[model samples]
Target: MGNTDIFLDKYKQLENCAINEFKLPPDGSAVAKLEKRSEFKDIKYELNYCREVRNLLQHNQKLDDEFPVEPSNKMIELLDTVIDRIKNPVRCIDVAILDRNLIWRSYEDRVLPTIKLMNEKNISHIPILKDRRVVGDFSDNCVFPFLLGDDNCHIDENTRFKDLKQYLDLEAHPSEVFKFIPADSKLSYAEKLYEEARNRHERIGLVFLTANGRSDERILGILTAWLIIGQ
Candidate 1:
């Protein structure tokens, strides 16, 4: 009926989330399950604190004298937020689906589709994959000079991916413009990589999402500044 009641209700909801939603082990008590779940490894102490407080709420039929029976709205809000995040951890694949910029094409495929993808999607940076791996990045900025200049040879939209190889510099700067991470990575992990690259003052034009977060892993998705920033 009061703030404390509301707080207790929220804690129940959180426990339900742990069991049904996150699928924490049902072998022991809720506290045991919270501690056992590897997903809470990063915040075990915080979880312990919540368990302690929730325990007091459950066992202590206290007079309002022992503790603040009425927790401040801000306190409840903050704790709820932590529980919510624990319930719903964001993975890189979750961010991947948000990007309409994913335009994967093989080097042997036609270049026209790449151009159309750029215009329609309003995207410039792209990964050119060969045999399910990213070979290089492609963009109008890199390919435009050839189109603008009066090159002796004429290539049209029908020109396949190989044709652009002649004009576009496919050489990737090793220090700049990408790194790979698995789809299961947390968004924060990806942001950390981006930050590290920026701190090194590298170009960091794109981040290639792969199945296992390795050079040999199959490309699953791509990440750009906007997609990460927007989230």
Candidate 2:
């Protein structure tokens, strides 16, 4: 019934937060499992410290001289951060951070200087759309590789996106290299999709955020690997 109680209560709150975030039962194992999640990786060590303190306090009848009777300011901050993160995950568009800088390619527009733009701006992927709705992605990987292949397909600024389709193999097609996620989705969901793509040996060059994670939804933003992996 003192500072130790307050600290213990704080840790208990964090456990509950993790439970809700993971949709698991309120138990030590659930919180432990959440500690290993990528979204929570930034806070893993901090959560570890809080867990240790909570464990010591719960198992002891009295405060030990070895432990700080009152949780430090840093500990309190850690608790607050973990709770906030678990309760409110940062959305895909929020982390995309390049919302204003998003480059676009209209499916009907003639082929662009994709490599030149990518080099000048250091961009890895650009979203291609059909009348404001995301249709697919255009990445430097597909561009350079296609150019290296047979030159039978005449590609120039006058070339249209549909024209380039014939030159690109199915594996290297722009349409096959992107995924859609709702703007409101947690970045974690996007990460899982990327992992799934990797398991299938397909590279997801871009993750386009839209109204409802649909290809036909108006493009709201685009997420590159750099942004998704944390930037």
Against the true structure, whose TM-score is highest?
A: 2
Off by over 4 Å in 1: 1-69, 72-77, 98-101, 144-155, 166-176
State each model's CA lDDT, in order: 0.68, 0.71
Per-model clash counts, in order, read 0, 1
TM-score, prediction 2: 0.83
State the lDDT of candidate 1 residue by residue for 1-231, as single tens digits.
677777677777677666775566664366546665544556667667666776777787778554445555654674587567766778888878433445667778787777777889787676777776777667755566556557564557777766666444345333346678888888777777777777878666677777788967777887777877776
**Structural similarity to truth (TM-score) of each candidate:** 0.60, 0.83
Instruction: Give the top-scoring candidate (lDDT).
Output: 2
Model 1, CA-based lDDT = 0.68
List the pairs of residues colliding in candidate 2. Answer: 111-159
